[model samples]
Target: MNTSPPTAIVRGATVRFGDVQALDGIDLALTRGALTVVTGPNGAGKSTLLEVIAGTTPLTRGTVDRDGAVAFVPQRTALTPRLPLTASDMVAVGTWRRAGLWRRLSERMRGDIAEAMERLAVLDLAHRPFAALSGGQQQRVLIAQGLVGRADLLLLDEPTTAVDARSAELILDAVAAETARGATVACVSHDPRLIDTAAVVVPLDGGRIDQSIRDAGRGRPRCPA
Candidate 1:
């Protein structure tokens, strides 16, 4: 067991959009450096849970204690295809916080972007316009972008959607790389292969987690209250 502190903890968290409750008192502890897969049926609020973990959505009730920077890759539909930026340019956006305007990318920044793209197997698409790529390709680029940033918490919503087996493996490898670097990875997924890589499996239904399976290899995980 790593025995390190968790990356985030949700206690009685609730998120309501109109009458539909996206997250209904959801509670889960995202273990540091461990990959957690969020599984649920359609309209089960899997996306909403990721948003809450990313801190992009305000909770309607209860609390979320998050520790450290976050990187989020939303669903493909959330990615804007209208941008004229190339795939690399889109990935470089993750480094913009440090590169900023007028500041040329340092060697480290350039390497980070390259490594992220390479891990996602999208390096060849670096010069291609994001909008011109296929949906699977665009998803890979978005994942590359998310992985390039300095985030302790990685929240990816259905990262493997439309991705081929090889591409999906590459993405999983990238997520593994992030975990090896001590980041907590949380992904919303329906893919069964990912279950083997996860330290915790949370299954949601109608906006609430019905059960959570802690990986036996990690011993028993203590989710803080």
Candidate 2:
């Protein structure tokens, strides 16, 4: 790790959507180079937490502050089903920060995209239309997209929900590599098996985090709860 401070900080965070209290008094500190897995059942506010960290969700109370750039790959991307973009094209969008919206890609950028696709085992699907891919394939491609360019904070929601065992391993391996390289990677998943690899296993229930488990991961890591 580069000795950077927490990549993201959430203090007494709360989010309300209509009648739903998505989050309640959440305090989280996402440290750099840690792979934190946020686990919970459906409606446990996992997705909302990711959005809040990414700065896309409006909080009803509390605060979320980031130390650097953030990249979020929602469990389901909002890309229209009819868009005629290829899987590779979708992943390349990660490099848009450097390759302007309408600009061309240089050799270096192309290499980065290729490497990211390969990491997720989606390099062979480069020519396939994104919408035409299976659910698992689409999920892998979306993950590759979030990794195309290095972001200080990388957020993923249920990244392996639809993938098979092999693909899930690849995705987790890639996420682990990102944390090893100094990115704060926060993943939301319901699979408890993931705890075996996570630096921090944060279990959410009733819109509140289990601080006992969370505090253990403050500096010393342990297996999932």
Candidate 3:
């Protein structure tokens, strides 16, 4: 069994928006190279959990420790429409945090962008305008962007939404590939089938984890749900 501590840890997390509790006393551990699927009914705080993991939302009452760089793909596409950038350009943005304005990208950085596109099978579309692709293609491009910096933690919110079944499968396959390469992934989705590909399954209800299942193939047996 892999004995390493989790790459990301959430302990007694809680979030509230007025009277409604978005998240309540949630605790989770995402191990390195592990794929964890977050599934539950609507209004279950799945998205809120991903947001906290990515550092987009501050915790209301507890703690989240994200040890390495993190990446996020929101449920809605966040591409800049007026930027007139290509798909490759979008991928390059991942590195901008390291080389902000007034900095030039090194050849090595450029190579990483190229490799990311190729890994997602979007190399041919590298030169395509970001706004010219369909929903699924755009999703893949965003994923490539997220991976450009070798982000250790990736949080995807409903990545398969609006895409065809085949496209969704492609994205899931790529996610599996990322996890195999030592990136921890937490994906929020309404689809329960994704549980099959995950090392752990977390089910949310009314803002808290209702059940947790650790896949038996890699880790010690978890208490029955």
- Compared with the true structure, the alpha-carbon lDDT of candidate 1 equals 0.85
Q: Would you list the rank order by TM-score, best first?
A: 1, 2, 3
Deviation from native of the Cα of residue 176 in model 2, angstroms:
1.3
User: What TM-score would you give candidate 1 relative to the actual structure?
Assistant: 0.90
Across residues 185-205, which tens digit of lDDT does each residue of candidate 1 receive? 999998877766777788888
- Evaluated at residue 204, the lDDT of candidate 2 is 85
* Residue-by-residue lDDT tens digits, candidate 3, 45-117: 9989999888888888999998888988886555465568888888888887656755889998889889888
The all-Cα superposition gives candidate 3 an RMSD in Å to the true structure of 3.1
What are the models' TM-scores?
Answer: 0.90, 0.89, 0.87
In order, the Cα lDDT scores of the candidates are 0.85, 0.84, 0.80
Candidates 1 and 3 compared by TM-score, better number = 1
Error at 110, model 1, angstroms: 1.7
Go through the candidates in order and give the C-alpha RMSD of each one to the true structure.
Answer: 2.7, 3.2, 3.1
Q: Identify the runs in model 1 with alpha carbons over 4 angstroms from their true place.
A: 100-103, 212-225
